[model samples]
Target: MAPPTTTNSWQHPSPHLTRVDAFRRQVNRRYGLSLETYHELLRWSVTELEAFCRELWTFCGVVCSAPPERVAGPDDGALDRMWPRPNWFPGARLNFTENMLAAGLAAHPDAVAVSACREGGAAWRHLTWARLRDETARYAAALRSLGVGQGDRVAVVTTNSVEALLVLLACGSVGAIMSSTASDMGAKGILERYLQIRPKVLFVESRVVYNGKTHDHREKLGGVVAQLRKAVAELEVVIDVSGSSWSDGRIKSLDNFLDVRTESLRFAQVPFDHPIYILYSSGTTGPPKCIVHGGGSALLQQKKDFILGFDLGPDSTYYQYTTTGWMMWNYLISALSLGARIVLYDGSPLYPSPDYQVQLLQEQGVTHYGTSPKFLAALKQAGIKNMPPLDSLQMTLSTGAPLSAEIFEWFRSIFPSKVGLVSATGGTDLVAGIIGGSPLLPVHHGELPAPSLGMAVEIWDANGKNIEDTGEKGDLVITKPFFSMPITFWGEGGEEKYRKAYFDTFPGVWHHGDFVRKIVKTQGYEVLGRSDGVLNPGGVRFGAAELYGIVDQFSEVQDCIAVGQRRKLDADEQVLLFLKVKTPPLSDGLRDRIRTTIRKQLSSRHVPAHILEVQDIPYTMNGKRIENLVKDVVCGRTAKVGGTAANPESLEEYEKFVDLPLVQSSAKL
Candidate 1:
């Protein structure tokens, strides 16, 4: 396939004045190299990682007590372990929270650090840098009073508010690992994640409001507390952020829990690879994997992404619509390191109305607005044609799923031309993107602008051969260990589990499980959905995104999912397309148009064997489609609905197709 012609929609007026270009010039001068362009600088970064990382650390002005003796440790002479997991910044000692607050406290103590809003609220509340630091200090003192120290786990069940940020900062300051999930998660889901880490202290919200509805979690909290106390012998206390009048003796209000003293805020300096956060997998298929991330690594990688990838600064207002459960929420908090004001919204993006959300973005003067494809699709379906001119809005980011070309083009038509629409692909496993947009690159129609700096990204076929330049779809693999790679998995056999998850298929490469294609001409990447969910028919494999890209162009289709179904007697897997129409009923004419459009745009093998309209499509709690789970049910396998599924009942609609009869004859359109 040929790459689409690129257009220069957004570019720096003066190349030398851009932030990345300036960084490149500085690196060239320091290293005595003649790198000319941004692409050349990226090549240098991946090839000469030691010098690049050392320069980046100094450029970001990381607050460290002591610098590393060397960038990376010497190779241990193990072939399989050489590139898979390289030790970075050995003998360095720093605290994540200290680095985050250093710039803000020193330069902008009175500036607004966080702006937040609750569901259906009319006003936004601001938290200044001084207040953030003071509150975090108080929380740290409180945790210390409870004997929370290094390597301990502190779990939170809360909303996206200032309180969540405070808890994360406090835990990171004391070297305690922080993990949190949104209030909407069921008790089972919450336990499945927290139980693995066995947190010593738990933070809970008494109540949460979403879509203009208040949900009381008192009874659910009681059950969880009882179960956790029995399961984890180390559990000591539970803190309530809402100050609810609960009768439980173990629960304490926020005011009572804080043990304010005359001591100043102290940061516990730990090793470079010390665990600071424990992020969980989606847990749609089975139990969620507890992946631990290093403090120094997460800080450096996220700062690089925010500073260079998004061009965030002290004056920039960063807003990412995320709950505590998603990795994007963690990424959003990293903006504090740059002293950028972060916006937190705790509600459905489509609540009240799509226009209401748009108005909030414009009114907040959001410079970097992070969002998802579903939100954009909803806005397009609602016929929202006009929006207020957002002069401050520079970029709009989309993740969690693939963004179709139809919606991308539609969004481009409605949004300001200067605002670059960036579609990035990453996961909880890496804590950052492998391929994303850059401030210096031009935005393509439906492709990520470039691979992230310092990441050796490649597309490999089934035989572990690079196929990126050939324009063929294959597994997304990182050829070298990156800064944000998980330190380890929790519990017994942690090393084995970590190795099996990413390094089992390829001996030393990190298989990210995403099926992707690179456009050779444009040098952009297209993430076709997950590799495990790839559909195979007549020995040709393709991702579900290819089918959805074609069918989404129709105005009548609201949303859809494509899966592969193969029973015991079938020789080849059959492609099944399920649609949730905007109207009550889908007409036969629309089905024919869908089939014909797919066959014309893609190949005949891409056409679905059956096109059926359904009431709804299943998605994970993080808003990712459950294609692999649906495929299991349609292939005569028992699908165990997990806590991560947002709407598990939607899977029952596809169970009837398990015994579907094979087509007697191929019908020609």
Candidate 2:
């Protein structure tokens, strides 16, 4: 837990470049080779993963109908046929919303493909790409006149706008699977994730706005459509996006669930591992694990992390503050498959104040924003120095948690030095990013500027060897199998819950429970967060994101979590920390300057025996940081708190830290 030094602060020079050096000089002139660095085209994209996915499916023009004669097939005979599962694009039929409405109507059928707004600053709305493909072809002809189709399952619940991206492009243009969540979850976490995907069409959201309050989910959508029509007997229709007069016999309304003479929009080609979306698993400490995801491997791994990791094309706009229950809103609507407009705010990126999402990312010029790390530590504790220069902001990203090298040097001291502040860390079981950001490398303040092209990702240890060139700190795994992995995990022992959630710790590799490292003087990758919430204490392991990057550089901390408790006759693990304080009763010289700034920036075995203030810091409805449900309510256990928890009453203030006195300490170092 000690590798931080490496500081180029930010680089990207080479004959001045960006579309990842025009996709590494179009993979060095279409693979003649001699790839000069994005770490040698990410080590020739994880060792020639089928010629780097057939040159990333012909450099993302991917509107496949039957293209793959084979871009990776082998394995599947198992008995460790070298970690099996490799069949991406074997006879691919495609149609993830017809390659995102044929790349947004062949790149800009009158531009603006979905702009949106809604929480307190309303009137923005837009849509365009021929009105989002004629409102997803009248919601895919009203879900095929309510018979739904091709592997069904719809869902929704809503709110991330433009009618939840036209119900996920009308359930991926009828190959159907969708599953969404936000509209602030609960009706028992939207019937524990649409009663495990029995969803034959739900949609919902009769009112939701946020931080400036609105929320009238018509009595929680009539008790979640009467307990999902008595536990999903294949539900068969609900709709209601906004115009909910509560009629029950299978409800209706967004203009009687639109069919508008079904104005053309076909696309159901199907099979490249069909399914489509679903994505759950933050069931805090129970249920939730739906996962699924496929549609040509979530459209060729979110169009290769949005055209070579965030250089997103066709005049990129993006935005991503997320929540149609977060997989970054399914990686921000795959930025309309790269005809990129996106934006969709919906609510509270600190609603009416706190720089209202940096004035809506400088009045929506937003060239690829996506945020988190507690919104750059609440804009560096609201001192908010200067950020409105924006100038078509390039890349910012940051994922649900762990971004801190003091919030990437306070977001490079208030933005735009040619943006690129990335910091990703994949999750919702590989929706994307197994480590991220690359616009041809070198951003290094708190790492992660690599390991994502075809992600073989590494750093192992704790017996499963490969500790990524010994910069030590381990587990993040992956080892191979790319193209967005989750085509499983729904119910009925889903292949033993997808090999016990990622190959039961390394047998066939993909472990990814986080705790990474690989800095080796800046090859760049640092995560250090959830290796099952790492911590340990006396036995000294680390990463509650390295004590919330030294208690979030305290401007009297407005949030913090850090866990590891151990109780019931504990022999070690103590470390608690809590703190939710933007001014609270936490004094004692600000808890001895947050334990002397975690013993002077991470050491005294990473401090914390118990610092406690807590007024709220549970998080998960995609803003992550529940630290193993506050370390299972400080080790006394019984935690359960799930409904996607954006504060399940902040887990009852960590159950009073299981009767404190540092969990009945037996005085020892």
Candidate 3:
């Protein structure tokens, strides 16, 4: 992949940034606290934050302390040299299920935890903590009856239903590692991922609804499950949660799964490093690294993020726009530790109407509303000019991609100015944010502040040189280990490949694949974009990958590839795309779709608002379509193209048009 430039993306706002002075003024007006006083409240020493973190752990019921026996060589501090690498509760040993069970949800009695959201455009049904916990234990009993043990892996393909969340917790309680994907992924998408991590028991949902349409998993599940059974002999029972027919193991009510375990709860015990979940990234080659996070790490880090980062307390109610496939789903559910009510929507955020989310925000009294920048931009362009007052709202966290200045300004001007617009970034890799906006700081336009507490963050150049003194951009890197970082990748030869993935680049430091500036801007240093996918147009930096993800959902074309082509003589870039059409050839109608999609789905910056159509789209062997490679050829520059094509080996197919006159003009760099 080529390094980033702003051709495909960038905020048009001038470089006039709010440095330290202006930031201090915004703080005083909003919080009734000056920057100095607020800094006192926010400033944390390593020792102090560690203490607070432990308190959070205790509150969340996670029991981790250094084992009494001094395990030689790999002791707590000696385990590794990296920062934040699975700092387990150093002195205690406890079961994962026990912590969640001790949540004391009984006092809240009728307080809702898991609320079932059906795609039938129907109202939601809230599950009380009492009912939620009972159901979870019941599922645990059922899985145990099916012989699920502490070390086995239970795989699931599901939607964001109460059942899926309950099942994951159930697996954790019983010591069975949980791995799953959203029901919306296609056959190849699901199959390629599931095949790598052979789950012992498979849970498949029959169907899920998005927008106004319903999609069934029957076609893919049958073939996919068949293949999974072939790989893992331990694969025995199956649970179908879709509420539809076509099952392998006697159709079990997701509700009934809990019924079989009528006895008093029986939780299991495992090591601190026991695997909990297997999350995947959108990479092609070498087996989708099944990122394995530990039970201890997941619980503690989650508690830290919810309580500290977002100011989520026991009384707070939370909801984020997410699906089962996204990491936010996992993060959202963990907030249950705070005893806060979590509102889940299974259908598209804009399904039925664009006003759906605003309605939820007002009705649910959602204190922490997390969503993507794309969604907010869509709301703006869709003429959703006004919204129900979020009187009870405390924070609005935006992730999934960078928040453009226009989208950010819209919130400041049109949305609730009292509430903070927290643009946070963390991926499935760390299971937490490297740098996220905290309530303690003022929200700036299109930038984030300091790293989450305890995250030892630094930015490094290609040769592993640290970019100090703030304001300089470089590859975002983590200097030390912290809890919640993936312990390993499943199905790998060993930790060898896992280590190679993040460590090989900068030797000992963990090189996170993001191009960021460690600027001591108003708040602090923040990450910029995917270092590998940043689009450079002139001198601006933009995240092209995020731009594509937001723009593709516009429905103007079936799919699109946005790449910034570099010209030798010019100091700028030309943005191009290889689009696949579901409708007819490029016409005014199609162009309108492209423009509207970007404007409605994202801000004008992402619209590409300029596009091109190519006969064939080139992709890597693993199905990842490469945009940088195409851009390289589009600039009339020689690329690795001269070599054997990665996938669709028909290099000739690309050459036929890669240097074509029509294409050249469309993407003249």
| Best prediction by lDDT | 1
Model 1, span 547-615: residue lDDT tens: 888877988999999998888889778889999999969899999999889878887778888898889
State every prediction's TM-score relative to the real structure. 0.96, 0.34, 0.78
Tens-digit lDDT string for candidate 3 (251-328): 454655545638656667766667778887644332356788887677777776775567776678898878787788
Candidate 2, TM-score vs. the true structure?
Answer: 0.34
Selected candidate, larger lDDT, 1 vs 2: 1
lDDT string for model 2 (1-669, tens) is 212223337654332356766877888887687787778888888777767778788878888768776665654332122244666677778888878767778866997888887875587878789988887888888888888878888888888888878878888888888888888777788788788878887878878768877778788779888888887888877878788577575688888778457668888887787888888888877678898988888778888888777778878888888878888888888778878788887888776766778778788788778888887787778766455888887778888777878888877766766666878888878777777877666677777877778787888878998978878898888776787788778888876888877888778777878888887877787888878888776666768887778777777778878788887777777778888787778898989877887777666777777787878887777777778877887788888776777768868767867867654322333
lDDT of each: 0.85, 0.78, 0.64
Runs with alpha carbons beyond 4 Å of true place in candidate 3: 1-73, 76-80, 83-87, 104-107, 120-123, 247-261, 284-286, 468-470, 520-526, 535-562, 566-657, 660-669
Estimate candidate 2's alpha-carbon lDDT, on a 0 to 1 scale: 0.78
Candidate numbers, best lDDT first, in rank order:
1, 2, 3
**CA RMSD, predictions in order:** 2.7, 22.5, 8.6
What does the lDDT read for residue 453 in candidate 1?
83
Poorest lDDT segment (10 consecutive residues) of candidate 1: 1-10
